[model samples]
Target: MALEDVPRLGCGRSIDEVWAGIDQPPTGHEEHCQYCQTARTRLQRLQEATVALRESDLHDPELKPRPGLTRAIMDVARAEVRRGNRLLVRTTDHGTIEISEQALDSLIRIAATAIPGIHSRRCRIDIRTLPNSPHETTSTARAPRLVINFRVAAAAGIDIPKTVDALRQKIRTAIPAGIGIDAGTINITVEDLYDV
Candidate 1:
């Protein structure tokens, strides 16, 4: 890999590859390359920190993370991948929240505006598309999963988690049950807490 590729690796590179260069030291052109040197230094520091943390006897729940932590981490990481260059997502809210990554912003704009709720203003929702693998042969399978992110009125004395959970259930029930098409994954992100 080119020297420039080293720093661009971010956290994606394998630890072995990183350590190999750091331990053995790259010769010739690589020795003079600043990018590789910086990457090596960063990797070494990260390794040291990881080792030190592992050896520490601290038992903080935050550091250890609760169960399903990996799943949560993946969710956040996947959102970044889905967001890409798109900044706003809109869908036509027609008493039902039908959201998907494809034409997401436009669809959210339509859906949210149709719903009646003054406090529901300024709701931003992002839908991520999840494609079905080729190995799975389902004739009725439609598009990929859609992850929805939105903000709604929270101060309506409503149970936020229950409401969100109900909304998700409604989406799952209505989409395939009514339309007979698998509606991709729906992820809802509540951006702002509103007082209703």
Candidate 2:
């Protein structure tokens, strides 16, 4: 018989049901049912394995979340509630280049983290478009200029101004290199200090 046609257990209790109540003391019926005993044993082993994996991930530095992870998550959540904003990079007769705010925020975070002893925090990007001239065509209209406001935490004993300068340079380079657009004005704020 096909797997779908077979009953989950001889006692008619599914493995899922047994697993859900695994923490509680087994009922009288479970004590007498071989299927319940077997399912419970297997599920206990699975739970043990899951716990072990979580511990491993915690100890692994590479698996640790980046500095701005919480901010990034909140940004995504807000974007979901209100549709994500997109920036126009360039416009041509053939097509236009655009990048989502979420994507650009992620890129900026990546650039900030590249500098040692720096942890990214909140990042916000603003765009201002110059009014089109009467003679300017759609393809010829100027692209919007971007302003980036970024917050970060610096490690103790690090030179704040020098490190921030490096961070600004990195973002300027990364923006144009990663996506074909210039980073107009970058403002970096050192909000807090963290131990190494």
Candidate 3:
């Protein structure tokens, strides 16, 4: 069948079949023949770039998030997403990306950190504080509610629960607003009730 007559892969043929069909020597039909060559070259380049990107190292700080790196990674991710793959967009610059689960986590943490009253270094999100903890007694009107644990070296006599509540509010506000992600849930557990 003429290249034009052949069913397009996307428009459904297996990759092997497509490759085999294209590899067959072009017939004398100039129009379809040229189209086949162009399609082959384009697909080859895309495959080459995909392999190159897969082997790329994005772990080193110097290379981890270089400008435009995220966009490059996102380009591939978007392609996959369009192909029915569910993937997260970690970073993007003009459209490319470098998908890294660690990077996404860091982004989320940074978003949480940006909240006012949240000490970036000292505070953490999703920590589990037991119901009977020291701070639970302040509001004993009902079942002890969980807290978003923010470990801080706070001064003695400071109300840990109160401080955590304020931090939680800041995190909730900053996360969606600053990073555009839903602030899922915050359960602050104060591990280091420091003397600060």
Candidate 4:
């Protein structure tokens, strides 16, 4: 067989089948095929390394979660949220500031979740502005018009329409001024009615 073909025999067989004899009873194929011989030698070395690792792990002391691990993870996540690209909320004659998409979504979730009897699952945000709609000639784009979709479940025994209306009002108050959203634009899907 060519030098390249030695590796092809192990392709279809599992490593367990090829290395069955190592640290165990001998298999008969080791004497016949040069490919199997070469593969067997390499597999023996890997098996030795793995056994050493397992023995070391067994001898080591038990590992426990670090103190304040949850707080450290949350701090990292908050920093990542702040570092995201902030959308252009609007531009003024003096200067401008921005907010990240992640932060915006978080606020929307907070607004929807705050309503009594409502449990919000997910939310999506969309922004669009017409091309050549006179904002092009302007220095900055228009305050981006947005559409928000909310998925939620209402608690049993609560009036559905009232709950939805309350949600709409809360969201309206939650959103900043000059942003174009309304009861019509706030799409709420009632997924289920849950007790307690």
lDDT of the candidates, in the order given: 0.53, 0.87, 0.50, 0.70
- Cα lDDT for residue 103, candidate 3: 38
> Taking the tens digit of each residue's C-alpha lDDT, what string does model 1 give over 23-125?
5657564466665667778888987898788767376566676899899999999887665444222222233234343344444445444443313334333
lDDT of 2 by residue, 1-196 (tens): 7756644888898777888888899989889899899888888999899899999898988996898999999998987855678877676767877778889999999998789999999989998778878776565468678899999999999999999999999999999898767889999999999998
* lDDT digits (tens) for residues 41-66 of candidate 3: 67677777877877675443556557
- Cα deviation at 112, candidate 1, in Å, is 8.6
Q: Which 10 residues in a row give candidate 4 its minimum summed lDDT?
A: 176-185
Report the poorest 10 consecutive residues by lDDT, candidate 1. 87-96
Overall local distance difference test of candidate 2: 0.87
* Candidate 3 local Cα displacement, residue 163, angstroms: 0.9
Window of ten residues with lowest summed lDDT in model 2: 132-141
Write down the TM-score for model 3. 0.30
C-alpha-based local distance difference test score of model 4: 0.70
Which segments of model 2 are wrong by more than 4 Å?
Answer: 1-82, 138-141
What does candidate 4 score on TM? Answer: 0.53
